[model samples]
Target: MTSAPSVLVVLPSLVAGFLACLGLIVAIGAQNAFVLRQGIRREHVAAVVVLCTAGDLVLVTAGIAGLGPLVASRPAALTAARWFGAAFLAYLAVAAVRRARRPERLDPAGTASGTERASRRAVVLTCLALTFLNPHVYLDTVVLLGSLAHQQAAAWAFGAGAVLASTAWFTALGFGATRLAPLFARPRAWQVLDLAVAAVMAALAVTLVVA
Candidate 1:
């Protein structure tokens, strides 16, 4: 049985963990854009959300287990990640550009034709690459959040809160994005979105190279 006082002490750390994770994740990025696109298309939303949350869970757990410092110490690894991530992002950007040139309309059901839809394997691979290939993901979860977790009295509790935050965020983003489906029914809307996605990916790739 836990005492009230102990519970009180744990609550703040938990809240802090939640807020910290939310701050890190609730941003515009390649991963978010991919999820949003899939959601709007109503293609494999649940799988994408689950994989994203799971990736975060694994990274955050590694961070909490004291791998954060070791990761931070290895600048070479991060540089390697950045290069690979930049190349991947560039490839995605070009693909988005090509997609924009051939925009397809969404049906009333918010799904494209079967012929136009990507295979589950392709989507899964892209989602995994977007989630894990980025070095910022490492810095945010492993180095930054891990260090922050250690600052709290109950590190595992903090990690739990962080994981919960990630799960909630990805679920909301991937699922909630469907609310904009009607607006995206037009082919022009999809073209604009693909162009926007291309721009963002290109900019991020440039930033990675110059950083």
Candidate 2:
């Protein structure tokens, strides 16, 4: 059998990429807030996790393939992305505020009965919009993570490591946050969470608009 990949050859780059990506991801923002909310509600957890991770992988690949310079040079494209992101965030803010005012019942069967169950397609589309529409996500995961990783290893290997990191991080976040589901069983708790989500989305929207 061929020799196993050497830690010396792989570990440093992988660790670096993981840390870089994690640093970018752990910031309290629209995406993280939305994911945390979904996790707490235990709604379409797998689909949301997979879609988010996959979106990051695609963006990271684009950056590794030298798309960063192109993205940087296109001011109009970035501007449009920012505006679209702001609009999406605004929509989320409104939804969250409404939920905060009138909290949803947590009875799983009841929730499932009302055509309120989150579909996989909806989860995927939401994640794709959140990840791709925000120029910040592209700049962080694609340009920053890609550039940093590529500096430490070959383009393909760096991309591979970054993608792996995204998958691992999002999977852990989606499942790990589920442990807090019990806390959200109370409508009051959900209202609080919804208010927090609304604040985060609005804050991000303001930042996007200003930037």
Candidate 3:
């Protein structure tokens, strides 16, 4: 039922959507911080990428399907989310600082069998919480991306492109960070990384609480 020109109209929107999502995603956030650490350690990188990508997909879809306005109207929900997110970020900040003070090699094979499974479980849960609890994530993917997609003639296609961008970015971030493992080989590098992460996380936490 769609004409050729009608289909072509979606291409620009698709590109725009991709760029828009990328601009928002490629930032220093809790989700990204965890992914980078996991990537460097090579611990469940694939799973983490999948979880983050799938989450973005679902959130973006919900936003485009008109969940943005409803989310916007719920100030109490956002407030709760803000508090939870801030608390989590604060915890991450402390963890990072501790890691910085006493840097350890992020050996994938170092963790014991029992501890590995438990740690992985904790990582997965943390990833989920980081992705879901952050109100900013919803605002970016759901509110901004959703709003942008609604303007496109090919809304679905545009949404697909945004989701694709999210997937590609996370995949690159999660996998590409490992390439820098050689640089992070030194404990000092990890200390610097964790310290920076801590600073960023703490600042974000404070910002969320006050804002």
Candidate 4:
């Protein structure tokens, strides 16, 4: 009798891959906070959401397609990534501190005409920088996820499924938070959010340094 077709191999792998990928993504950080803020502000909501999700997809694809092995093989590259990521987090911490100190003017009148445009650009740039600049993202998504996916029964299919999970999670977060913009309209709320973001960035920086 012929052995079972290789196609059967993909089924179990896909499930394992999805869970592994989701676990890595659910951690809240500067990136997720920025996306949620854009959503709450209703500023470039669609563009910011799509850009973040799409960027993750690209990185996930790169990781699965042998880039993981390349990075793992290069000790210098990984070390550079760690330092770069730490520095970027430090920069974010400074920005967050500045926002926290700024005076809050809640009235729509205080909202500049170019606010949305600027926010849109900031969201895209921040998402890309957070994803690509930091070494942790590469280590987690590329090295960890890629390596784990390959070990599964159907490596390629599992990796693709995991990438899809990442896309779905970010998209949902971006759009879902936008619907709550009214709650964030208050100046105090924005201040709190800014402070919280600053704290998170600082903590991430510390973690990077210690790691």
On TM-score, the leading prediction is 1
lDDT of 4 by residue, 88-142 (tens): 8888888878877762433333366423234556667777888777777888888
Pairs of residues at least 3 apart in sequence or in different chains that clash in candidate 1: none
Model 2 misses residue 147 by how many Å? 1.6
lDDT of 2 by residue, 150-172 (tens): 68844566667767777887788
How accurate locally is residue 9 in candidate 1, as Cα lDDT from 0 to 100?
Answer: 67
Candidates 1 and 2 compared: the better one by TM-score is: 1
Task: Estimate the TM-score of every prediction.
Answer: 0.94, 0.90, 0.92, 0.85
Instruction: Give the Å error, residue 74, model 4.
Output: 1.9
* TM-score between candidate 1 and the true structure: 0.94
Per-residue lDDT of model 3, residues 61-85, tens digit only: 9999999999988999999999999
RMSD of 4: 3.2
The weakest ten consecutive residues by lDDT in model 2 span 106-115
Q: After superposition, how far is residue 98 of candidate 1 from its true place, in Å?
A: 0.7
| lDDT of residue 153 for candidate 3 | 79
